[model samples]
Target: MAYGEALALQRDLAQRRIDRSLDHDLLLLVEHPPVVTLGRGSHAEHLVAPKEFLAAKGVELFEVERGGDVTCHGPGQLVGYPIYDLTQHRRDLHWFLRALEECLIAALRDFGVAGERRDGYTGVWTGGRKIASIGIHVKQWVTWHGFALNVMTDLSLFDLIVPCGIPDVAMTSIQKELGERSPRDLWGRALDAVVLAFCEVFRQQAQMVELEAVRSGA
Candidate 1:
């Protein structure tokens, strides 16, 4: 699904939690429209596009409730939504975020891409350009929303906005950086890498389950 649709689904999943139906432990992977999303309390100046221009460009804007400044998501990006119960892991948000970064780092390592975290920043990076972005919201000790990794996303789309409010920082993709060594089967390899990373970093055995998409209101 698209990132916008996935965001809507996150809301739906949260509502399901409110209604006490859906499992608190869930992870979803999706991409988003070419949109710039700013987190809570982020400055409007961070976005380089005017409201009208963004609409004209077919890009949507969202002032999300996550815990970061601004970031972009579009096609060929891998966005992960991990809906997990923090209570199951001692309610350590820091630990959870670290684990998330570590998971991505491990996944990238499998592809010969060395992913690392900045001293104070959250997302994974290689050299100077950021390859992944993370912004999440937690409610009732349960977490939702998550990270977006640039697999083969159009790096130019990032030029239209200030990514995570960081200026002059480059953006990259696995395919772009790895060059000849990058996996030809990106989606398949990424799926396996991320799932493996999840199990390794979280120190838990996760059962991969598949479910058919339900029609709206069903």
Candidate 2:
């Protein structure tokens, strides 16, 4: 999905949840074409790529309302936007961030990846290499703009920016951790593990509702 489309979907879903039109929280999963997003805290220097360079590469750049610095998104990355009502969970943003990390860590564990949380960092890492990036925005105790796990992402694109504004940062993927290439098999399993982890972490029996179901406000 395009970032703009996903952002619009998040806003619509967030509004539905806030207005009591949507009864349950949602986790929207999507893989975007190559793009760079600058969040509220993003710095111009962090995005080192020139506009002409990005345009030449066909990588779209968007300024977003999420709560982090510049980050790259592309194909083979599992981007999850959880439209969650913090009121139903904990009202604490810190707790919510930890919950997201826990969910991804657990999901990575299922794939034999030992994901860890680095001290002073707000994302999940493994062996000091970031495997996932998380940033969120909440309003009225409802949240949006969640995390991105590098399943098989092109880490080269991250060079366009100082990812999450962290200098000397290294990004990894499930494929890299496993030291192998695939027939694109692991992404499905990884996606399933993520959904299960979310269910377990949040204590909800989530059903996989289609996008149409969400679009129709069902």
lDDT winner: 2
lDDT of candidate 1 over 17-102, digit per residue (tens): 64567654677877777888889847787787788988898988877889998888888898898877777776888888988999
Which stretches of candidate 1 lie above 4 Å from their native place? 18-20, 211-218
Angstrom error of the Cα, residue 218, model 2: value is 1.5
Q: Please give the CA lDDT of all the candidate structures.
A: 0.82, 0.93
Which digits, one per residue and each the tens of the lDDT, describe model 2 over residues 27-91? 99999999999999999999989988998999998898889899989998999999999999999
Model 2 CA lDDT for position 167: 97
Give me the displacement of residue 110 in model 2, in angstroms.
0.6
lDDT for model 2 comes to: 0.93
Alpha-carbon error at 165 in model 2, in Å? 0.3
